[model samples]
Target: MSIEANLEKIERLTSKVWRSYSKEDPLGHLSFNEYDYLKAIQAARVPIRLTDLAKELEVTKPSATNMVKRLERKGLVLRVSCSEDARSKRVMLTEKARAPLESESEIYTIIAQKLKVHLSEQEFDALNTLLTKALR
Candidate 1:
């Protein structure tokens, strides 16, 4: 009933929603760190530097490098020399990662559709706006 109580409830529900979304994908069996790396590469669209990936994931450089290496070995990602900086390497998603990303997107679409069954269009729009504002 109180503002704090409402906020807490929202946070809990949002976390559950995210977990549900994550689990819905058969290909999302990847660890959270791996999924984060894949998502970042998908979003970057360009060769992303290891330092930048580390910063984006809020992890250390060595941790990012290790993760990239794992993805590279799995054939999900490739490490390429940065054109702008000869000494630096960039991570790029390989075609192997694309199918998994697409599967995750489909999972989210199904989750969204299920949620829409419970929420009115206006309520969903307001929730989206609130989440965008919170991120900012």
Candidate 2:
């Protein structure tokens, strides 16, 4: 296949896999962007400030605020007033977000297992390396 065709195929296959995995799960309601924001908040050492989250996600502060609002409405996150800076709010994951976060990791593990079963160890390692490089 041509490069463009191969890229398109990859996108389709990934979407198919994700859809299949998420179809019965509540996490399916979340967009990839929404999941990313939650994942970032979960990875933080403490409840993260909005400005810091924007920096970590490499998005504008306003963009991060908008996404936080969406996640808040979905009951996945909360914006608590920062203790040190009362004017600034910190993003935190709500109890509701726990299952989706765990489910996301499970989806990745399933994908990795499927790939490892189909490819030789070297091919799998090379694919992982190439994908990491390509993403960067």
Instruction: Name the candidate that leads on TM-score.
Output: 1
- Pairs that collide in candidate 1 are none
For model 2, residues 15-130, the per-residue Cα lDDT tens digits are: 77788887777666778899889889999957999999999999999999999999999899999999999899999999889766766777787767866897999999999999
- Over the stretch 32-111, how does candidate 1's per-residue lDDT look in tens digits? 77988999888887889999999998999999999999989888999999989999999998887877686666556665
Candidate of highest lDDT: 2
What is the TM-score (0 to 1) of candidate 2? 0.75
List lDDT for all candidates, in order: 0.82, 0.87
> Alpha-carbon error at 5 in model 1, in Å?
9.3
The whole-model C-alpha lDDT of candidate 2 against the native structure comes to 0.87
